[model samples]
Target: MTHILAKYLVDARYEDLPANVRKEGVRTLMNWVGVAVGGSREDPVKRSIAALRPFSGPPQASLLGRTERFDIMNAAFINGVSSHIFDYDDTHLKTIIHPAGPVASAILAFSEYHPVSGKDFLNALVLGVETECRIGNAVYPNHYDVGWHITGTCGVFGSAAAIGKLLGLSEQRMVWALGLAASQPVGLRESFGSMNKSFNPGRAATNGIFAALLAAQDYTSSDGMIEAKRGWANTISTKQDYREITEGLGQRYESLLNTYKPFACGIVIHPAIDAAIQLRNQYHLTPDMIARVDLRVHPLVIELTGKKTPQIGLEGKFSIYHSVAVALIDGAAGEKQYSDQAVRDPRTVALREKVTATIDPAIQPQQVDMTITLKDGRKLHKFIEHAIGSQEVPMTDQQLETKFEGLTDGILSQAATRVLMDRCWQVESLPSAAAIAQAAVPQG
Candidate 1:
């Protein structure tokens, strides 16, 4: 399985990808850039930049939304953190891995160091996403159930595969890189809610770059570290399906499964939020309609995001009650809806208290059953079979542009944001992939 993946990573070409797959890569890149820049001024990002600035080796790569640059690896780490700070980055729903942060962050940072063309960059992005997601598929329920953050645990491989491809690592060196990455899995579910949640993906990005660089120098690691009896699979998960990693390498692209978040919070709550907003808008129901919202959701929704009253923005992300309340009242669930102020708002709190969720084994993770009971004795219900951002109902290009605008509105000048958006959409044609990162910086 390792050898097969290495060959695919090393030999895959941009032209080999189907047009839609190539386009999906662009979508992932666009969404990643928006989230990274949007979260650049976040507390976690600010503190990380402040702490690392003095010791940063060299300004070799640009930070996505800020003017500061750092050595390639450090830049990868910071950008990865920023991309995931809002919990709004793209996700491979099968394993719930945020596909771009570790892979794209490392590759784009490496692009600055190596001058990679846009076509090559896109190819690397697709391969990297595929690598992590496939590995994620193999160990998902077990690995995730055991409290490992699947993105950080699996993302290092994506990062290493991407950077290794760019560095032209041989099959043997690529195997070594994967082995090294395997030895450095990151993030625990217990860390969710703190800045460390975002740190996992960022550190995975840096770890991958570290592994690849060392492998390029002929640093040795056990080649079977991923699937060996005592290797990552057996050590980290009780069940292993090697076919998930080895099957349909070039034919099936996991990057195609990538889903972007329309709401800025956790994906598990998206279905309920979608249903709530739809009901609010459809009936022109205001929060004052004197209603209680009832939700029947998948068991994981309550397990992962059942917070009844979230005191902070990060905690708000884990609160399905808060998500539905804000969605119903504001008709949106963007970052503002999950803000510290929003979480503490009296109106939000009142509505949130009226919202209740119960686990329904019949409901799918992407589906929700919502009932809004009003003072007028009118009961309106919506059963969302699939959330808007799910693969079944993806956001349109126009919708994605709207999201990007919202994220950048107050941060980047209109002209700068427009330029950055254009660069991201047409990234495959650029002479250098770094242009997108350069354009993302806020203009004074």
Candidate 2:
């Protein structure tokens, strides 16, 4: 009668998550808040918040973008969407799961309605992140290759489990919640460049909450939904090591492995970002000096981030060529690097056209190698063993703070941003979850 999934959920809520996990969980939340606020001005986020204004629920949670009495579900939907609008949210490359948006959005919605403590909110986040990374690891080559956005699709179950833990669901009930979540998974890579990209995480937060609520009401789905023959495995997996999901569930903290995004682009291009940054700094290279740029990268990155003619910010965010060009010209890659101006810059666009990538099958998705040939016929080679913000080289507290402040500077003033960052750092000791949520998404 022991359900490993339920045990992990309950234990994570009450005990298993350590101090570091809680601290990191809140940090992830803080970074997510930054992206959501920054995305407030994004056309995609604006359009959806505007669209949902007329479909208000109960004024449960504050939509970060606008001043409206949005329901908890709508609040989650909008917040989740905005978080990924710029593709700046944190990533767990090992699982290929976009962790922050879905988990933070779901927790924000829950916090508005319930008066749970920040420590408990952190617990739910840790649990949710675990579920997210686990599923992503299990699917591996097969599920993601089939064109499913794992962050949005599998993220629902993680969001549901986290919400369930926060609501204090029983062990059996948490299992039911997972089943309910499994039945409604949705997301497609085909929708990458459109508004639907944000839609995936939005639905994940809303539906995940619904699944948990329904399960608490004794809603039942197939008992073995996760590992069942015709369950997630059969429906979503291929060439996947299903065993990876359960192997380190209780022993290791998966959220710790999550990578923070420095550039508002696909994680696959992160190595390219590192390499570009290296080249930019080493030579203090100017765009005019670079005659032609060539990138030797993993085949997976080539497939995912090889957009050659990006016309918009979102499209540029997914394009390696554009990102590399901007980093080289600007000397730094920031949220602005993905702005319309940056994306549509004639200089950047022209430089991007000169940059070409060749596939290297040996270089895995988690890594990238670059060999840049400058106009002077000088070759600059940079091997980014790991992206800067990844677990291999995690962002220090000071760095994460700088990222939060820099990203939220104009949006959230110094005083407000400091308060939010401080609260997240010691979330385990906060008064209540509502305090954390309010500090994050203030009414403007």
Candidate 3:
């Protein structure tokens, strides 16, 4: 199984990708850059920079959106954290794995170290996304149900594969790199509301770089570490279908199924936010006009995002009620909507309290049935069969560009932000991947 994967990775050419697949890779990169830059100045990112600066090695790579540079590995870690700080990165809807943080973060840093061309960088990215999402498909709900953050758990494999490909590791060493990655999954659901939640992907990216670098120097690990008895699959999950990883090597790309978050919160809360925002716009509703708001959603919605009253911004990401309240109150659910100020706002708090949710097993995870009752006894309803950012209804390129602009508006000058965004879109034609990284850093 390991050798099969390595051979495919070794031989998969950029020309082999479908046009849409290649385009999606650029889209993924563009989105990752935006979120990383947007979250660059967050409190968690600031603390991480302070904590790691004392131990950082030689400055070899850029930290997207910031002026500081660090060793490639530390740069990868910091960039990964920044990209995911808002919880607004790309997701493989099937497994809810945020794919880019670990994979892109690692390779962009590696590109700085190795001088990878944009073509090769893009190829490695598509392959890395495929690697993690396939593995994610094999163990999805089971692995996730057991308290693992699927992104950080499976992302190490993606990171290792992408970096290993860039390092030109032979099949034997690629196996070792993956073996090292398998032994180092880095997240738990218990960390969701804390800074540790973002740490998982960052650590995964750093670990993958470490794994690939070691393997490039002839490091050896169990070749069958992923499938061996008591190995990753058997130990971490009760269900393992190897076909998910090996059945469709290059023909069917799972990276194409990647979805970006329009809202800066958990996927489970998107439906409610979508419905609420639509209702708010339709009726121009205010908190005082709302009597009661009710939501019927999947059981997982309540399990994953049922926080009725979030005390802080991070906690707000996991709150279905808070998301809907803010979306209705503000007509948008961006990072600003989930800020500590928004969470503690008297109007938002009151609206959130008025909002109630019930688990409806029949409702799809990406769908919500929302009903709003007004003070004068008018009832409004909106059923979101497929939320805005779902695979069924994905965000468009122009919309993604808008999202990018929104993220970088205050951080970079308008002209500089546009230049950075254009570079990301044209990444495949660029002479070097380092150019994109360089453009991402704040300019004087």
Tens-digit lDDT track of model 3 for 165-247? 99998989999999999989889999998899999999989998898989999888988888888788889999898889999
The residue pairs that clash in candidate 2, if any, are 291-375
Per-prediction backbone clash count:
0, 1, 0
**What is the C-alpha lDDT profile of model 1 across 206-252, one tens digit per residue?**
99999999999999898788898999999999879999999998898
252-329: candidate 2 lDDT, tens digit per residue: 888887778877788888888888888889888888888887777888776888888888877887799998898888
- Each model's RMSD to truth, in Å? 0.9, 1.9, 0.8
**What shift in Å separates residue 139 of candidate 2 from its native position after superposition?**
1.7
Flag the better candidate by TM-score, 2 or 3. 3
Q: What is the TM-score of candidate 3? A: 0.99
Off by over 4 Å in 3: none
- Candidate 2: what lDDT? 0.80
Predictions in order: lDDT: 0.92, 0.80, 0.92
Cα deviation at 168, candidate 2, in Å, is: 1.5
Candidate 1 structure lDDT? 0.92
